[model samples]
Target: MRLSRYFLPILRETPKEAEIVSHRLMLRAGLVRQQAAGIYSWLPLGQRVLSRIERIVREEQDRAGAVEILMPTIQPADLWRESGRYDDYGKEMLRIVDRHERDMLYGPTNEEMVTEIFRSYVSSYKALPLNLYHIQWKFRDEVRPRFGVMRGREFLMKDAYSFDIDEAAARISYNKMFVAYLRTFARMGLTAIPMRAETGPIGGDLSHEFLVLAETGESGVYCHKDVLDQPVPGEGFDYSGDLDAAIAPWTAYYAATEDVHDQERFEREVPEDKRLHTRGIEVGQVFYFGTKYSAPMKATVAGPDGVERPVHSGSYGVGVSRLAGAIIEASHDDDGIIWPDSVAPFAVGLINLKPVDEATSAAAEGIYERLTKAGIDVLYDDVDNRAGAKFATMDLIGLPWQVIVGPKGIASGEVEIKRRATGERETLTIDAAINRLVAG
Candidate 1:
């Protein structure tokens, strides 16, 4: 992608409505544009990062044995009524009516709908331990939606539902999601701490919320300091094996959000030096609600003994869109966002300091083609913009690697390579630069 032909509408000044750094930076960087109070239209650059995050979430879900299936954005209100939550869900639910006066709604969550789907064709225990997931947009009518996408009324989410025959099997499903969440956040260069959380309207006794610590977070959290430095399971971890032992290291610590906090117990358990109290953003939540929706909606399966039983179920959710803002909150500096390598919209950014110059343009064009053919997402800055403006835009968008081609450098038969995170720049021959980027 070349900046000369791209649609990056970077703001020269910060917007007054943006209250926090992440919100401001997102607007200044031209990643998202607000269409309404809390609804946004993702631009080209922002959409690329969003897609990358979605892919990571999907891959991790698949590794945990969850199958992918897309659900609709709009749903009939009868499904919510069947689950006994039509009125109980309150004003947060976006209730509507069709032309014929039938109750409809833009779904805030999919528990009732997923339960209805599960009971439709899955009748025998042979289909037990099934997990289904979807990446889709959801709507919730927040009374005060602010902080950009971090607390948007309309946002994208990756929600998964697991069905099992009994409580014991449901626990296994929960553990799979627990491990999957850890790996998913780790891929985005975040250390998310899993803490006991209130069930809220979701309604379940067993629930955990994964939070990423940030100075400007919405909720306060308390945990052990070791959790910040704990090692996440690596790529080769066997998802099929028993994850109980793998997760023990993380669960050994006492962690809780404000809703579930026990100050006295925290004081007794954690030493002063080991205690860590900070503000955190909730990025994911998992709930194992035994027969919560299944029984009410008649989502039953036949047991081995030939008895019909309500399948124990669990729901796992990751804030796919909110994570982009949360990540910026955790990783940005004074300049702009510092994207993680795995979730960077483009792997490499090639800047042509002198787009009109024959030598500089040729060098940048060659590098861009080489990087693209090598399977790297490269953004070439071929726009007729000043060097400072080009640098600022590239930093604001936060590509991991940047290659600068200027007349002076090209005259020496070399280009400058800079790492966005560390600001380390090195001058290398054109051949050597291409080799290094391809190898990475």
Candidate 2:
């Protein structure tokens, strides 16, 4: 992508409404533009980051054996009614009437609708242990939607629904998602701790919220320090094996959100040196709501003994769009966002420091072509902008690596390679720069 042709409306001054660093950087970096309160239009740069995050979430979900299937944003009101939550869901649910005068709603979550899908075609123990997921936009109409995409009225989410024949099977499915969430966040350069959390409107006794610790987080959390360093299940993990033992090391630690925090137990379970109290942003959650929606909606399956019973079910959710903001909150510095390589908008920023100089432009174009040919995602800043402005813009967008091309450097037969996270720079030959990045 070339900045000359990109639609990036970067702001020089911070917006007054942005109370958090991520929101301010997102605005200044021209990632997204607010259309209304808590609503935003993701610009080209923002969309690229969003797509990368979604890709990681999808890949991790697939690794955990969850099948992907997209569900609609607008859901039938009758599905919520059958689950006895249409009215109970409260004002957050955007209730509407269609042209035919039938009630409809923009789904905030998909438990009721997924249950209807499960009941429609799946009806036996043989079809048990099925998990379906989708990445789609959702709306919740927050009464006070603030903090940019972190607390937006409309957002993208990856929600996976699991169906099992019994409680034991449902727990195994929950464990699978548990490990998946760990690997997902870790891949994005986040150490998300799984903590015991209250099942709010989702209505489940068994639930865990994965939270990334940040100073500006909305929720207070308490946990053992070791939980932050615990290793996640590797790629070779067998989903068919005992997932319980796989995640036991992480769950054994004392971790809980404020809603479920037990101060006395926390102190007793963790030594004073190991105890950690901090604010954290929730990135994902897993819930085992056994027969909660299935029983009420008649989602039953025939057992091996030929008896029909309500299937046990669970729901796993990762805040797909919110992660972009949460990641900024956890990873940004005074300069701007320092994106992780796994979810960066582009792997490298090819900055032509002197676009007007024939030698510099040619060198930059050659380097850009080489990187792109090597299957790397590079954003070529071929625009005629000042060197300082170009550097600021590249840093603001936060690509992992920046290859700086200038008349002076190119004349010396070298290009400057800078690491965004560490501000480390090295002058390398064009070939060396390409080899280093390609090998990365």
Candidate 3:
């Protein structure tokens, strides 16, 4: 995409309302604009990153045998009533009435709705181990919505529901999502520590929250240092097989968020040197609530013995929108957001240092074409702007690589390539630069 013809609204000054680095950088980098207190309109750059994150989440979910199916943003209140949580969900849920005077709500979560969907068509042990997921918008009217998208009222979320005939089968489904969450976060360049957490209104006895450690995180966490270096399972991991062994490595350690933190346990379990106390931002969570909704909503499936019973169910959630801010919190430096390669809005930033110069413009245009043709997402800054401004914008947006083209460099038949994460620069021939990027 050419910056000259693109819609990147880079902010020259940081907004006063931004309390943290991630929120400030998101605003300055032209990612999202606040539509209300906690609602936002994702701009071009933000939309690109959001879409990239969604792709990674979806791919990982698919690998774990979760089938994709989109659910509606609005859900019928009767579904929540059927699950005995219509009023118990509290003020966070936005209750509404339609013209027909029927009750409805902008769903905060889809537990009850999904249970209703499950009982509608699935009725036997044959479809027992089914997992369904969707990436969709959700609304939760936070009393004090702040910190940009990190605490937004309306956000995009990926929620997967797994249905099994019994508790043992449900555990298998839970482990699939647990292992999948580890791989998913790792693929996005994040080391997420799975911590025992309260299910809150979701109401599950077995629950784990995946958190990314950051100085600017929201919750205080305690864990053994060993979890920091735990290796994630590789791509060839057998999701079809029993995952209890794979899940054991992570569960062997003690990690808990403040909601469920036990100070005495932390002291007794972890050695003084191994005890890690810090802050973390929750990126995802997995829950196994045996017959929690199924029993109440009568979502039953016939067993092999021809007895009808409530299906054991689990819900796994990945914050599709909050992760954008969380990634910035974990990765950014003083300049701006340091996007991970997998979730970068654009892989390469091509800066035309002298857009007014014919030779420089031609060289940049050629390089941009080559990079684009090489299957790289390159944002070419072919606008007639000051070099410093161009560099600042590039740094603020934080693409993985920046290719600089100018008369001096073009005269040598080369361009300067700079790695965004490290301020390392190299001058390479146009062919060499293209080859290197393509190889990467």
Candidate 4:
């Protein structure tokens, strides 16, 4: 996208209400706009970043063998009543009545809705292990919504539901999601540790929350320092095979969120030198809520002997929108958000230092074409902005790389490339620059 033609509404000053770094930067960078007290309109640049994050989440879910199936954002009250959470869900559910007088609610989560979907077509143990997922928007009325998208009322979420014939089978499905979450966050350049967490309204005895430890996090967390060093499952990890061996290392260390944290136990389990007490942003969570929804909703499947029983189930969720804020919270420097290469809105920012200059424009334009043709997303700054302004914009938006084209560099048959994360600059011939970025 060329800056001149793009719709980035960059802000010169931070909004007064933005209490957190991510929230402040998001507004100033023109990634999002506040539409209401707790809702936001994701701007073009924000949409690009959000989509990239969603893609990685979907890819990892697919890699873990979950089939994609989108469900409705608004659900009938009858479904929730069947699962026994309609009234219990309280004011946060946004309960409403249709013109026809039927009750409905904007779904805060899809447990009841997914249960209905499961029972509608699935009726046999032959389909015992089925994991269905979707990337969609969800709404929950937080009384005080703050921190931009990090704690927004209406936000995007990637929620996956799994069904199995028994508790043992359900745990296996849970482990698959566990490994998938590890890869999802790792690919986004985050160190999200899976810690023991309360199930809360999700209704499960076995649950884990993936926390990206940062001082600015909302939840206080206690963990062993080594959990940060645990290796994430590789791309070649076999999802069909037993995952216990792969999961052992991650679960071997001690980690727990504040709700489930035990200070005495934390002291006993981890050595004093290895103990870590910090706050964490919850990015994702997995729950093995065996038959919680299925039993109440009659979502049962017939076993080998033709006797029907409730399907054991689990739910895994990733905060698709909140991740943008979380990534910024974890990775940003004083300049701006240091986007990880995998989730950057654009892979490269091509800066035309003097777009009004004929040679400079031609050089930058040529480089942009080459990069785009090489399957790279380049945000070319073709506007006639000053060099200082161009550099500041590049740094603020935090693209993984910046290719600076100027008359001097163009005359010397070179363009300067800057790595946004490290601010490392290298002057190379146009051909070499393209080759290096393409190879990446």
lDDT of 1 by residue, 262-355 (tens): 9999999999999989899999999999999999899999999999999999999999999999999988878898999888889998999998
**RMSD list, candidates in order:** 0.9, 1.0, 0.9, 1.0
Q: What TM-score should be assigned to candidate 2?
A: 0.98
TM-score between candidate 1 and the true structure: 0.98
TM-score of each: 0.98, 0.98, 0.99, 0.98
lDDT of 4 by residue, 191-253 (tens): 999999999988989999999988888899999999889889898999878789888888998
Clashing pairs for predicted structure model 2, backbone only:
none
142-162: candidate 2 lDDT, tens digit per residue: 999999999999999999999
lDDT of 3: 0.93
Instruction: Assess candidate 2 and give its lDDT.
Output: 0.93
Question: Who wins the lDDT comparison?
Answer: 2
Model 4 stretches astray by more than 4 angstroms = none
lDDT of each: 0.92, 0.93, 0.93, 0.93
Clash count per candidate: 0, 0, 0, 0
Residues 21-79 of candidate 3 have per-residue lDDT tens digits of 88999999999999899999999999999999999999999999999998999899999
- Candidate 2 residue 120 Cα shift, in angstroms, is 0.8
